[model samples]
Target: MARSGIQYADVQQAIDALLTRGDAPSVQRIREVLGTGSFTTISEHFRHWRNEREQNRDVPPPKGVPEAVATLATDMWRQAQEVANEGLVHYREEANRKVEAAQDEVLQATREAGDAAQRECALAEHLHHREERMEALGAQLADSQAQQSALLARCNNAEQDSAAWAKDVGRLKTRLEQQTSEHAQQRETERGLFGQQLGEEQQRNEATEGKLLALLDSVRQERADDDKAQRKRTQQLQARLESASEEGRESRRELKAAEETQAQWQRRYEQAENEARAQHETVLQHRREAEALHERLLRAERTLDAEREQRIQEADWQVSLSQRLDALQQQVATLPATAPENDDDKPAEDHSDSPPKT
Candidate 1:
């Protein structure tokens, strides 16, 4: 089973937060902040992020050896060329000497063979008249002819050897030319490879720069969204507070009206009590005139008591209503001045779409 990590937006937010805290983001640090990504996945994304950053920035070319070293290399190459040319001249001279020497030996052998033949002819002419001398002259002529045939064979062998040496020299020269061409081609290939590597590095740098710009835009957009949300939440709180203020005003009006009604009832009760007192005084004066009036006076006293009790109950109801109104005003006062739009300060919950950030 594999655990998923946060969404790209969340990861970006985390990175921005880390930057705000002056911390660099690495695979391990990002994972620690996110608390859920696989190490391999984090490593891959981090590599991409770093590449984007590098592309946005300029990268200087790698420093090679100092100018002194380059000068030294040039001098060494020149010396080697000079040395090779000298060796080639020496080799050609040596080969020509060998060929000339071989030809000279062949010519000297030919002249000696001709001289031997002439001397044998002279001996034959001088010895022709004597039979014993003629017999000895025939043996010498046979030996000379054998020696001439051996010399001819030796000359033929020398010619064949000379031809082989010429072919060997020609092949060696061709091989040297091929080696020189191959060395030149090798240097060309090395230059091509270096140029290709440099171009690739430049391309990588450009890509990194583009990515950094995109990330910056994303951060800006997110900030704008946050600000908008805050403004909306503030407006909502203000509207709620206004509604509560209206309700409080309505409650206060009702309370004031109840107090006015209570005062009117109190005035009515006092007027009734005054009337009862006047009737009691008239009853006391009439009791002396008529004993029958005494019963009416007692009934009037009972009616006054019932009316007083009813007024007391009404006053109690008014007081209860006033207290409830006060309580409603307190509740309206206690309402919060502003409501939160979201719990952004707290860590987010894990969901299918996104993981938690630490």
Candidate 2:
């Protein structure tokens, strides 16, 4: 028979075959059928089978064996068993072959299951890594969004500031234009006034130049006349001196009488010369007084011209003021009249209704 502890079903089949053949089976033949080289391994299988049989004693073996087969001899029985064991060994070998095949299939399936579990663990790790990457990307996206919002807000504020500055610039430009126009008008008015003053001053200067030229011509004429009178006086004095020298030479013959007459004539000539000098001084003094009077008249004329210009300016101002006053009076005259209150403290209308006049 195959080893008794080989699968119970397998051992039972071999035992059945031995009983049917009417022979005793040997241990060697059983070992050969079991295909086990180690006695220790066969012993471990028998111990396991004995323990299982004790626990489940009521269950029968898969194949039935007669009780007589257990009592056979050692040597003749071994030989007889060899004949019977031949069929039993073949049956046991077939059964053990099927069991080994099933065990190898189970081992392959277990290895495949372990490989699948390892792949599943690796895929789970990859998924976790991808999730962490996605979280970091999401955080970066959020920060970028916040920064964009801040930039947009700053742009909006800058736009508002630009608009305000533009408004201020426009207001300042308008004021500048108005001021420039007013200044231009004032400058024009001042230019007109200065032109008028320049014309008046030019006229006064021309008049003064004419008077000065006249005065210079009179002085030159006076100097020429004085030079002529001085030459005549000098010729007269030279003639008188020659006559006195001749009379003195003649007087040497009549010394006392001629000397007294010559002295008297010299005294009279000296007195006349002194009187002429006094008259010349008086004429010079009168001429200087006349020149002073002429200068005073020129100054007075200049003052009069200035006064006339001032009067003209005053007249223009008065005329403007009068026109303005007239306009104001006309405005006042055109205004509506106020009503007086009566004894009843109610205002009365003073309307004089008439046909509309053209």
Candidate 3:
């Protein structure tokens, strides 16, 4: 009669198949081969099968069997047992390797999960830092904008002041030109007066010479009678010539002084014009500098805006990474906490004792 367990035949057949194919078999392997038995049931069935084979071998030969035949039969059974034992050892080693590999895989998975968590934390920290940087950049940009506004206002004021200064310069030039014209007219008037005075003096000198010539003729005609009168007239004519020469020299000196005064006025006018030009040039230089500063500010603002946009993009990417990390964390949380049912019913793997012999 068969031992307990309806799967005994199935287990025996699975073992037989493994032996035919030169494969080591175990309770776990038998379950794998059958695809539908628990380890406890399969191990029980395998033990029963081993017992039946051993019992059949131990049955004494009937009707005086030959000693050589019995010895040969025993030898064959021993060799079979040895082969089965060797196969079992190889199967146990293979099972141990598989278990270790499974443990290693579990460890690897745990490490990967840990690494993922660490990465998520790092990403969160980095995101926070990015947000802070973005805030700082925003503040900086606001400050820059305020500064730009102030600078623009200052530039506008400078431009207005420059315009006012230029207008003042133009007004001054106009006034100076008017003064110069008036001064020139006055100088012409003085020159005309001096010329008239000189002409009158020349006319008086010519009249005196004519009168002296007439007196000389009279003295010559009178001879000794008018000698005293002629001498007195000659002395008066000599004094008159001396006085006219002195007046002409004084007029020449006055004209020379007037020319010098005109020259001084011209130099002053030229100096004022040069000073005005220098002021205008200075204003132009200031305007150029302001323009350059404004241009640089514009470029910096553009750069800041671009960086702000890039930071925004990075912030969005970080958020996506955070979402992925959340999903991963959830998956890790859902992992199984227990081993498989087959592992629970697994047969003893460390025993080296062979099956009981007949």
Question: Which of 1 and 2 is ahead in TM-score?
Answer: 2
* Number of the top TM-score candidate: 3
All models, RMSD in angstroms: 85.9, 56.7, 10.9
Model 2, residue 62: distance off in Å is 29
Ranking by TM-score: 3, 2, 1
For model 2, give the 10-residue run with minimal summed lDDT.
338-347
Show where candidate 1 strays beyond 4 Å.
1-141, 202-358
After superposition, candidate 3 runs with Cα above 4 Å error = 1-233, 337-358
Per-residue C-alpha lDDT of model 2 across residues 78-148, encoded as one tens digit per residue? 45434444545555565556556555555555555455556546655655665565566556555645655
- Give the candidate order by descending lDDT: 3, 1, 2
TM-score of each: 0.20, 0.33, 0.40
Instruction: Encode model 3's per-residue lDDT on 17-71: one tens digit a residue.
Output: 7554545456667877898866667766776765565555444555466666556
Off by over 4 Å in 2: 1-98, 203-358
lDDT of 1 by residue, 67-180 (tens): 664454435434433443554455556655655655565455555545545654554443333435445544555555565556446545544554554465456446545654
